[model samples]
Target: MLIGIIAISFSSIFIKWSAAPVSVQGMYRLLFTSLLMLPFARPYTGAAAALRARDWLLLLFSGCMLALHFLLWMGSLSYTSVASSTMIMALEPVFIMLGAYIFYKEKTAAAAMLGMAVAIGGVVLIGWGDIGISPDNLKGDLLSIGGTAAVAVHLLVGQKLVIRMPSYLYSLIVFVAAAVVFAVYNLVMGISFFHYPSKEWGIFVLLAVVPTVFGHILFNWLLQYVSATTVSMNILGEPVGASILAFLLLGEQLKVLQWAGGLLVMLGLGVYLYTGRKKTAQSETALPSAS
Candidate 1:
């Protein structure tokens, strides 16, 4: 899970590194990632036979959401600071919590709520420092928020379907579907998919393989051993990791307030994990003895 978090933490950096338009970048990233997984997932044959009509429909919806998430998130980079965008994007777990409660009937504990509040506070601080209330940044922020919401929906839908399919297969289908959506979007927007320089293509390939494939595979693997809440908590580390990387690689700097906000976010996430574990332990103990 830690490695997955770290690998996904590099997503924004790689997205920024690519010179292609947002739609094209998203299309190629998913296309390459799906192609790389074809041998293992075998989506065209065995996996296809395994999936029911409903599963395919759900996967298609999830793929559309994924494509929208990428489009908004990648586009936000042009108009907003990376720090603000990443901090906002980290709120995805919060949206997931809401979705779990509303759609899955999952009980959210008090500690989790508190942690979310603290994390939002941290996000606000980061945004205040990195984002101005200018029209452009506001548009970017709105798009970022929309991207976060789309991903939350994607995960909620994916959690149900993934139980029926192998993680790689699920990812493969979603990526192929998303690639088709992005390809059409790029065409409509007049974006040249093949115009990027070789260096940018190299970065795009790395983005597809590293963050999309390896990161997601590691995350899915961890789900076998850990609670969903635990996985969500771990994902809160992405903004922190991304921010640090942005500073080192992109020469991006944050104010002291922003740094303090990052600390607060981490502290809140720690509290969430601690309290969640305690609750899980208590629940385990509360299970009645069987015959």
Candidate 2:
């Protein structure tokens, strides 16, 4: 899981390094990943057929959400600092919590509510420090948030379907669907898919293998062993890892206020995870002893 976090942490950096358009970068990344998994995934064709109609629907929706996520997130890096873009991705859990409450009637504890408030406060601080009135930065921040929301939806929908298929197989299907979506999008936009330089193609392959294949699939596999809250908490490390890499590789630096804001975001996420887990543990412990 830690390795997964580190791999995904490099995602934004690779996107920053690529010169291709957002849709093009996304398209090739998914294309390569799906192609690589095609053989392994072939064996699962029978299993996929066993999936119910609702499961297939969720899978398609999850794929579409992920495609939109990459499109918005990769696009955001063009207009804002990597620190801001990565930090904003941390908002995914908050969205997930609210979504569970609305859709599943899952009750949130008071501590969880408080943590949400703190998390939002951290978001405001980060936005203030990062955007400060620049329309361009604001645009980037909003795009990142949009990406975060899409990812939350992807995860929420995926939780139901992951049980129906193996991790790699499910990932292959999602990536293939995402690739198709991005390909259609690129075609509609008249974007050239094969015109990127060799260097960009290498970066696309790295993006596909490292983050998409290794990183995300590891998380999917880990879901069987750990709670989703635990996974989400560990994912908070991505912003930290991405920030450090951006500093070392890209010579990017966060202002003091920006650092403070990022700290608050991480801190708030920590509180959120802690409170939510505590609530879950309590509920589980309170179950009837007859079980």
Candidate 3:
């Protein structure tokens, strides 16, 4: 999880370093990631073939959501401060938990809802502050929130499918599907495919190998071993790490209101996770003891 958070922290820095179009960065990151996963996923071909028709549909849907997430998120980095963009992502687990409760009928905690409200208040503070500064800042904040929602949808579907398929196969299908979406978007928008310089290509590959492969893919694999609560809490490191990295590397700094809003976002989500973890612990204790 340490490696995963560090890798993900670099995601914004890489996008900030890039010269390519936002969607291109997303396209090639997933494109190269799919290539890297091909060999491992190939071994699971038999498992893939046996999946039901509905499974294929689910994969496509997940891919679309993942593609939207990357596009919106990378685009946000283009227009907003890294602190604001990454802090808004703190809502991801909240959205995912809410989606599960609404769709899968999963049990949830009222504390989680209260925490989400507080966290959202934090986002509203950021948005309100940004509105007075520039339209683009607000634009970036909205984009980040949209990206968060899109990814929650992707992971919600992914959590269900990863339990059924090998991690490599599931990841490959979703990554490739996302890459295809990027390809179509770029083509329709007349974004160049092979026109980028080697430096940009290198950045794309780094994005693929580091964050996509090591960060997000690693989390996907870990879901098989640990509770999602563990993963969610550990991922809170991204906003802090990314903000610090942005300061050190990109010289990006947040103002007073932004800092206060970021704090509320973290505190609210921390309460949400702590409440959920406590509930999970009690549920496990009462279930049974192994003989």
Candidate 2 local lDDT, residue 161: 70
Tens digit of per-residue lDDT, candidate 2, span 228-270: 4445555666776787788889998666665565577567667
Clashes of each: 0, 0, 0
Query: lDDT of all the models against the reference?
Result: 0.81, 0.78, 0.81
Model 3 agreement with the true structure over 1-291: per-residue lDDT tens digits: 779988998999999999899999999999999988887665798999999999999999999999999999899987888777877776687787777778778765678768767766665554344343588988998899899899888878887888888877888888999999999999999999998889999999999999889898998887676545446555556776687688789987655775676577667768876787788788789888742
Q: After superposition, how far is residue 255 of candidate 1 from its true place, in Å?
A: 1.2
Residue 102 of model 2: what lDDT?
Answer: 75
lDDT of 1 by residue, 1-291 (tens): 668878988988998887778888789889999888878754447767978999989999999999999999889988887888877887887788877888888887887779867876776676577888999999989999999889778777777876777766777888999999999988888888787789988887888988888776566555555545456667677787888889999998877887888788788887877787788788778886531
* TM match of model 3 to true structure: 0.85
* Two-way lDDT contest, 2 vs 3, winner: 3
TM-score per model over all chains: 0.91, 0.86, 0.85
Q: What does the lDDT read for residue 90 in candidate 2?
A: 72
Stretches > 4 Å off in candidate 2: 112-128, 225-230, 261-288
